[model samples]
Target: MTDLCPRFEGAMGIISKRWVGLILFELLDGTKRFSEMESDLPISGRLLSDRLKMLEKEGIVERHIYSEFPVRIEYSLSEKGTALEPVIQEIQNWANDWVTPENAQKD
Candidate 1:
């Protein structure tokens, strides 16, 4: 008898944060700016930045800085992050099937 896998726990630690799943889902389509992610998700800028930094550090997300007049920064999924699409999609499907609009959260 031994531990199954610490990697699974590590993954849960990453995705269990409130805004992380949404942020990954948002980035699934393509690259988006910080402002875009902020607007799309209901999370605060500070929290979003923190999550992005964590994901970047984990190699799940990639941040790109473009040299331009104003300087442009964008975020997109790395190969590791892209690999989560199926898992996220299944979660989305489960939510659609199980989470009723009446019981869901909204302001």
Candidate 2:
């Protein structure tokens, strides 16, 4: 027997981490500095650093360094990462429908 599901399992594995979704969501707005991400997300600095590294390795996020007094670093979504927007949106829509405040309160 063959598994019917397409093996998006690899891509799923990459984005399924706790902080990864918010990281991608933030990048959708535009590029952001490491400090900006750290401050915006609820994650610890070390965890954010690790997740950013992992996203970079997966080709979903690109990191750039600016030549300045303090040498700032920024992260933005790559082409592949931008492609995830629709998928994320659909997930949000589905959750909105099935996990409404009323529904949650009832449960």
Candidate 3:
């Protein structure tokens, strides 16, 4: 058998992290503020901040700042991140088929 491709392994290493995939899935809708994402997801503010920073560093997430009274900040997927939508969709489809509510609860 051929050895695993390093690039593919690297991609999976980032995507397979806890909350990472869900973050991507959520961002697929469009840009969102920190509080918006925090409320929409079940993750804590600190952890979500950490993950967003990591994704920003990896060029998967873009951070935007607006000049406003509250200094609004928003996050959106980069072109690279946008490319993940189809893959995420496929995973969603697979999960819908194989990962039932009961099956998911087992983990």
Candidate 4:
């Protein structure tokens, strides 16, 4: 029998990391600066940077740098990342239907 689980496991390993799903979801709308992501997420800057680097390496995110007196950088989802919108939406729907502060507290 073909061992198909590794392929699925590999994909899950990346998305299952803390902050990765949320970061991807945040970028789904459009480009955003590092500061904007930081502001939107409760994650620390270092952790955010690490996750962004991982996402970029995986071709799920792209980083752009601007030429200016004060250099600026922006991050956006790549084509591969944009492809995850439906998956993200379904997860959001599931969360809305099941997960909640009340449910969480009971766990």
Candidate 5:
């Protein structure tokens, strides 16, 4: 066998987690407050927070703080994160074509 590419391996390790892809997809829509993301995804706040922190640490997500009355915080994709859009979209297309709920049920 040939040697594996570390760069590809690293990226897949980050994005292949259970909720990471959905988090990235949601962020692609635009910046979202923590509450908004929590409401949209079926994940728990703690897990979501952890995932966000991980993504933030990886430079894939940016956190913005607003010193408003409630001290609002929002998340959006960084340039590095935005670069994954086409990859996500392609995966979505492949899933749509081959991984419907009906097919999943059969599996």
Candidate 6:
């Protein structure tokens, strides 16, 4: 059957991946370098790069490069991405209610 909530479906398609939420959560603090994100999320370099690119295309993330000897690049949440904070918080609250520490520990 066709999905009625196309907007939500599209958003879920982008943010429902395993690493996407962690990536966005990291950006919530501030901008971070590619290396910093890799260290924070502990994901492989290739997958992180791919997710960043997808988020950029979706207008939820921005990449900035500084001209330096080593060429530093950093990623930050776009305005659109910041708008998602409330939704993320609500999800967190919902999970807190239903997902007990005991259940979490089992997995």
lDDT string, candidate 1, 1-107, tens digits:
98869999888999988889999999998999999999999999999999999999999999999999799999999999999999999999999999999988774
What's the ranking of the predictions by TM-score, best on top? Answer: 3, 5, 1, 4, 6, 2
Clashing pairs in 4: none
Evaluate all candidate structures by whole-model CA lDDT and list the values in order: 0.95, 0.87, 0.94, 0.93, 0.95, 0.90
In the range 1-107, model 5's lDDT, one tens digit per residue, is: 98779998888899998799999999999999999999999899999999999999999999999999999999999999999999999999999899978675331
For each candidate in turn, the TM-score is: 0.92, 0.86, 0.94, 0.90, 0.94, 0.88
RMSD of each: 1.7, 3.3, 1.4, 2.5, 2.1, 2.3
- What TM-score does model 4 achieve against the real structure? 0.90
Model 4 C-alpha lDDT per residue in residues 1-107, reported as the tens digit of each score: 87779879899999999899889989998999999999999899999999999999999999999998699999999999999899999988999899987675331
Candidate 6 at residue 65, lDDT? 96
Worst 10 residues of 2 by lDDT: 98-107
- Which lDDT tens digits does candidate 2 get at residues 1-31? 9664555777777878877988998899999
Model 1: lowest-lDDT 10 consecutive positions:
98-107
**For model 3, how does the per-residue alpha-carbon lDDT over 1-107 read when each residue is reduced to its tens digit?**
99989999999999988899889999999999999999999889999999999999999999999999989999999999999999999999999989988777432
- Give the C-alpha miss distance for residue 71 in model 4, angstroms: 0.6
Weakest 10 consecutive residues, lDDT, candidate 4?
Answer: 98-107
lDDT of prediction 1: 0.95
Better of 2 and 5 by lDDT: 5
After superposition, the stretches of candidate 5 with alpha carbons farther than 4 Å from their true spots are 105-107
Count of clashing residue pairs in every prediction: 0, 0, 0, 0, 0, 0
Error of 6 at 23 (Å): 0.6
User: Which portions of model 1 miss their true places by more than 4 Å?
Assistant: 1-4
